[model samples]
Structures are given as C-alpha cells and as structure tokens.
Target: MSAATRAPRTCSIDAGSVLEQSDGSASGIGGTGHNAAIPSSGIGGTGHENTIPPGGIGGTEHNVAVQSSGIGGTGHDTAIPPGGIGGTGHENSIPPGGIGGTGHEPGVPPGGIGGTGIVAAGTLMNVSGIITAEDYTKKQLQLAKGDQICPGDTIATNQDAKVKIQFADGAILHLLKNTEISLVDYNYSPQQPELNRSLIILAKGDIRSISGKMSKLNPQKYSFKTPSSTIRVIGTDFLVTHLLQQEGALDAGTYTKVISGEVSVQSTTSTIRLRAGESSHVMLNGTQSIITSGGGTCSVH
Candidate 1:
C-alpha cells in the first residue's frame, strides 16, 4: 500500500510597524496599542483561527511545517495536522534556504561541506611585522624577534602591507612595500661597551627609522648601517637608501643619501658628519667622501 504524504504549507504573520508595550498590551509598530485575546489557527482540527495575542502585536502557529520538497519514506508518512500546530520538536535541523535567497538546491543542504563560511563583507587581514600578498594565502604565520625577511616576502604597498620595528633602546623602524631592507643587529644595553646598537642594512630599499628608548636613554647607541656608511642619528627620523653604481672593472660600490637628520661617517682615517641635503659615496677602498653638508674634504657626486 502507498503511504500518505502531505504537502507543505506556509503562513506569514505581519506585525507591521508594531512594538511591544511595557504595560503588557499589544502595541503596533506605529505606537498603537490593542488589548484583546489572540486566537490560534487550529488544534489539529478543520478550522482556521488566526490570532494576535493580548500582549503580542502578531504571531502565527503551525501544525507541521515542512519547508523542504522531499519524498517521504516508507513506514514514515508525512502529515501536518491542520490545527495541531507544530511544536519545537526538531530544532537542530538545517533551515531551508539557498545562497543569497536564490533558493537553488544542488541536491544537498545549504551549508554543506567545503563551502565558504559566511562572513561580513569588506573584512581586513591584520598582521604583525611585514605582510605581503603571499602571506594572506595561509591562515596564519609566526613573526617573532630575530626573524629575517627576504625580498618579495611579506610584501605590500602603502595601503596593503606595513612593517614596524622596535629597537631594544626604543628605536622604531616603519617599512613600506617593494622595499628591501635587512635588520643586521639590534642591541640596547647601558653597561660597559654599551651593548645598545641598531644596525640596519638597506640593500636597495627604503626604511623609516624613529629614535626612541635607545636614543633617549643613550643617544649614542643608535646606528643605521647601510652599504655605504653608518648613519648615527641624533634622536630623529630619517630615510635611507643605497644606490648601486654601474659595474666597473670590479664590483661597483654604493652611495648613501640623507633625507633628514644628521649622520656621521667614521672610517679608519677620518670621521665625516652628514646632515640634511647631503650625500656620500662609499668606494671599494673603504674610503668615503662627503658629497655635501660640510664634513671634510671629499669628492662631489
């Protein structure tokens, strides 16, 4: 014998522009209140009784609401009593819906496996140290002290990625993208030989360094070592970049340009000071010439 199968029914209750009242009275969204006892659709009987409870604006009851269009199995027929009103027997089942209200069921549930989880649009991915387009591929990565970064790693533009470096003595370095820089060493100590030092080798990139704890505690402990010379900051901000000269008989040397603050060059034979609007060239002979800013006798670039 064929089992009995019932069709799904849907009824919507519109509490149009109504709000609940503090006096337990039914208030419409438009601030109108009504005091009356609400009636139900039916209790598994042949009757239609719609209701708005005494203290409720609007609500509906169902006997057996089958939202999905599925076949009923044998020995278990589907039946929704008219007036019985479906109770909260099954609450852990998937609700019938589809992507963006499209309602296209691919013979599977809405939130099936291997589906992208729901999330708020325009979410940003924040990370520490350097972050590039590649880093976002994975869920997470570690960025701890004494970490070395290479080119194209953790790369990002001014708006995409950013890197912040804090020195032992409180110096900070903020680096932007398409920028290559190396953190050689960072030491901050106040004892003999003063272990506090900051060495950054800007191979061919831009870096912004801010003098902080180390500079305030011991101003002499800060240094930005590039390919050319060591930049001794006077507790100020500066940008450093190393430009490679054309290839010659041997490997070409590098030149340093100072955007701001004061940088001093100390070589075996002489000591040169560089200020804003000055440049220096580091030769293969370990010799440096102060191009400008009035340090000493040196060749002009």
Candidate 2:
C-alpha cells in the first residue's frame, strides 16, 4: 500500500485576523469568519481574487457587484443622472436644472416667484358717473366699484363724477368732479414698518385724503406732488385743489387745507407748515403764502 497523498494545507481565518495574499499583500479582515468586513481600499484574498459571495463583500448585503468608490456599498447606487440631486433619491441636495438652492421653483422667471411688477396700490370703493383710470401705456379703463388701482395709474373723473379710493395701508381718498390724480409710487408692509412709503400726484383736481398707517408711522415718507408744490403730511386729513390758468375759474396754483393733524407744503423756494384748520397757497412762481380765513373748504362734495 502506498502512502496517502498529502492534501495541500489550508489555513482558516478567524475574527480580526490578517489575510495574506500570495502576492505578499496583506489586509485586516475584521468580524467573525466569512462575515468579515471588506475594507474600502480593496478586498483581501489569495491572488486578490473576489471569492466573497454576492453582496457579501460589504456589510450591506443588498449592495452586490459594487465598486469600492461607488455609493453602492452604502446601499445607494452611484448612477445619479443630471437634475437628480433634488430628486427623490437626494431630497436635501440642490438640483442642477432647478432652483432648489435659491428657494425658487423650476423654470421661474428672472424676477423670482410671483414677481415684483405692477400691483394694486388701492381700490375703488365707490364710483359715480364716468370714472376712468389711464395706465402708463395710455390704455384707459373705466373704473367701477371695487376696481383695483395700481401704481403708475392716472385716475380721472368726468364732469359731475365722483369716486372714493381706499389704499392698501388704510388711507382714504375722495375725488371731486373733473379731478385727476396719479398714483406715482406706494409701498407698504405691516411686518416691515421702515419700508413704508407713498407718493401721489394731484395733477388738476379737488381731493380729500385721510392719513393711513404709512403716514402715521413714517410721516416723512408720504408725499403728494403738484405742479406748484409738494405736500407732506403728519398723520393728517387734508384737502388739495390744483387748477390751471386755462380753467378760467380758479387761480393757477396749488391750494392745501389741513382739516386735522398737520402738513408741510414746500415749493421751489418756500416751505410752510399748516396745522388743523389752517390753509396755504402755493403759486406757480414756487412761492408759498398763508391763506386768511375763508380760503378753501375741505369738503369733497
């Protein structure tokens, strides 16, 4: 009988044992037996062969046939396409084609969401006769009750017409017949009181105005402009009358009367402050003078 051929000696690796390859390379394989964790650098075995079962290389058994640099070892695929950052796979990352980083939606215009374009500055609360509003483009729109009045709009009332406007900041305006006024600019934010501002142009007309939150909070930021003077308020209810020489009825000047509170009327060369029950006249020459009793009435009727 011949001596039994000796089988090749094979060594079994235990937990936390070093695995040496035939090429003299060595790596630490931790954990128990075949469940040892595979290093991110490379797999360890004889001849560097991938002898580990499918999905057994990494601790995540679902990641099969994944490369070392791929996210597959972490249970996620590394094949993310364009615009995939904000997609379902990566909810916290920004997408390439969307504005996730800027708090905007995809395909939004340059001005941002909702935009800051023309917006309603006031609304027509009551309208009588023929009242119209002209925009910057010269487009005229007949106004009715509850009609929106935007900035850059010139509102006019025909003969015997009357209209009342309620501003966003709680101001009130009453326009008499044959009156015209333009809303130049208006900005109001209850949350940001410092940003409140307003400007109205009394071109030719009789108008009564009651101060609102914008004027009450920041009186210096609210103003009304006419051809002859600029009127600023201090939480006041006032009346303004502007007439041209061609009208042939009233003087071609700007007249202001303070019914309540106070106001400052400024011309090119003069400035005057008027309290309740006071009145002033601003001539075309940019001169201001106090009006005696019976100068003008504050009634919009």
Candidate achieving the largest lDDT: 2
TM-score of every model versus the real structure? 0.38, 0.59
The residue-by-residue lDDT of candidate 2 on 173-214, one tens digit each, is 999999999886565656545546688999998999998898
- Give the poorly placed runs of model 1, Cα more than 4 Å off: 1-170, 176-178, 189-195, 245-253, 267-270, 284-287, 294-301
lDDT for each residue of candidate 1 in 175-290, tens digit (9 for 90 to 100): 66545454433333344223244445565545676666666554575566656566667766666545465545423444555566666665444556666677666664557766
Error of 2 at 198 (Å): 0.8
lDDT score at residue 121, model 1, on the 0-100 scale? 10
Worst 10 residues of 2 by lDDT: 108-117
lDDT (CA) for every model shown? 0.36, 0.55
How far is 204's C-alpha from truth in model 1 (Å)? 2.9
Task: State residue 218's C-alpha deviation in candidate 2, in Å.
Answer: 1.7
> What's the TM for model 2?
0.59
Worst 10-residue lDDT window for candidate 1 reads 112-121
lDDT of 1 at 264: 64
Sum up the clashes in candidate 2.
0
